[model samples]
Target: MGSTGERAWLSAGLALLSEQGAPSVTLERLCERMGMSKGAFYHHFGSMPRFRTRLLAHFEAEHTTAIIDAVEAPGGLPARERLTRLMAEAIKNTGPELEIAVRAWAKQDPEAAAVQTRVDATRVDYLRKLCEEAGHATPDMMAKLLYLVLIGGSHVMPPLSPADKHRVYDLLLPLLG
Candidate 1:
């Protein structure tokens, strides 16, 4: 299949997952959304399981890249600043809908759980590296604590108000520093 068709399928599949959840990503729904027949869908993915595997891979790859990019952004920002920016961007990319989908799917799907575990590992590893770069004492503990705080906090709370969010960065910056 052409790249355009592949992208369309991914977009449609994500939409299905976000809008109606995982089970909603049926071949018929994808066909309906893409205006393609089951043949096209089958040609692209042998089965729904394959399609789901691809989608999860896409999510993990995209998010992992985003994290690395944020860290590499040219500005000489401190580690804490870089981490805050990365967290904000991640939350922006994974809004409530997709988060809900991931959470819902992870409960019943070991594959999804493993994908999430990889995501968590990537995040924690990144944090650990940043702490080490900053010469922070107890880098491992700081990284684990910060990762849990940022990720678990985001999972539970909506994005904070502008003032409160800035305050969060201010409070966290000194600790990382």
Candidate 2:
């Protein structure tokens, strides 16, 4: 087993985690669903903890790191506009089910909880700094509020339609300035 095996497990784990949450990400489930042998998972990850750690890192990189790069990419847009673009991209990238699963996992796993904390911090801090760059007088409080809205929106309701999402952005834009 090599990168192929590693990718297989990670892909299976992410699928299960997103569809059914942490409990569904068991090694046996991954092996069965991905049509891989148990030895393959072990060869790639060695243990459950290592697999989980890598999973979190992979999720972070896929979800957050790329967006960070995109938002910071050189453009004529102002910082506030860039932040708005980032928010739109983030909303597109994440599924509410996957987020809910991760949040639920955070309740039981310290590593998952820590990863959640870092994700929140990174996102909130990015908003804070962007607000600062855009000359918000109360960037700290605004960042906290905005981040809360972003996270809490899905937990509080069903998925927004595309129109609703645009409405939300419209509502949020004036506040950013």
Candidate 3:
């Protein structure tokens, strides 16, 4: 936590936030979790509002930017595997509770909502890129369906059994080819 830079505080803040809400993401709590002083947090972020700003940015950067870049990186998995990894990472990375917490926070804060909107757009665009790269017959439609399925499947319903996810993905492969 001492050496991980600003993200250490943000990560701790997120865990608190996911467990409770934005109100729980205080410097004292984050610093306590990290075994650091409030001065450490202030060293990276001047104040609470600034730390909150960095939290949302960090969430997007880790969850969206990092994952998407890895999937599209050079000499990795094939298109299908990449797409599978995309879905896996999309739903698995931060856990649903964190996502729900962020959305809840967004209701009271414009910055959080702005970040959410940007992240959603980035994800949908990433889905479109995957479809295009895979040469899907109906790339746009597939992107939309995949996006909606992920959103509905992950939040509205319980986690899909691995076998059931495989079954759905199998049916989706033909649409790609």
Candidate 4:
């Protein structure tokens, strides 16, 4: 576990990134925001690049784990149904704000971009596995398409109300059929 000061600094950094985008988040800026000395920031993270890497790694781990948990819950539901429900739930939980923040950060940091790629790959892999379990012939293609549609839809479509979300679930009925 990191020290309280270390955690506080990282939290401030994430807030800065989430609220104002990556370019506005520097060690100097974070230190000033937290009213901490440069020494405190340096104590936890060796440099700005290192801090960015750690932040991205943290986001990737949390997001992937949440996806895996949601899709693999203990149930006898059909694979396609589980996949759609899990993805919709993920989108609802992580609304557009956080997604937009990450996209903004990725545009500014190579490390963030790399982590985003890995996260997207992981999503595709999970979808492919689900399609395979459902006996789809072209699991890879199905997964890639499903992944794109889900992520793209989350951004483009309005956040579904509960009733509308179930209707959105119906749109996936064809895949299960």
Runs off by more than 4 Å, candidate 4: 1-11, 32-36, 73-81, 157-166
TM values, all candidates: 0.81, 0.90, 0.85, 0.74
Per-residue lDDT tens digits of candidate 3, residues 1-177? 224777677788889988988888987788879998878778888899988888899888887898898777755667777888887767567566777788889889999999999998898887887788888987788888887665555566675644555567667767787
Model 3: which ten-residue window has the lowest total lDDT? Answer: 159-168
Number of clashing pairs, model 3? Answer: 0
The lDDT, on a scale of 0 to 1, for candidate 1 is 0.75
Error of 3 at 142 (Å): 1.3
Model 3: clashing residue pairs? none
Q: Pick the candidate with the highest lDDT.
A: 2
In terms of TM-score, which candidate is strongest? 2
lDDT for each residue of candidate 1 in 1-177, tens digit (9 for 90 to 100): 237777689878888888999889888999999999999988888888998898887777666666577667877887766777765665556555775687688888999999988887887888788788777888888888766555555456574444454466557657865
Model 3 scores a TM of 0.85
Q: For residues 1-177, could you state the per-residue lDDT of candidate 4 as single tens digits? A: 256776677668767876787777798899899998888788889898788777676666556766687667767888877776776676665545556678777777677888888888888888888888888878898788766555565566574444454465567535643
Full ranking by TM-score:
2, 3, 1, 4
Candidate 3: regions farther than 4 A off: 1-3, 76-78, 157-167
Model 2 residue 151 distance off true place after TM-score fit, in angstroms? 1.1
Of the two candidates 3 and 4, the one with more favorable lDDT, higher being better, is 3
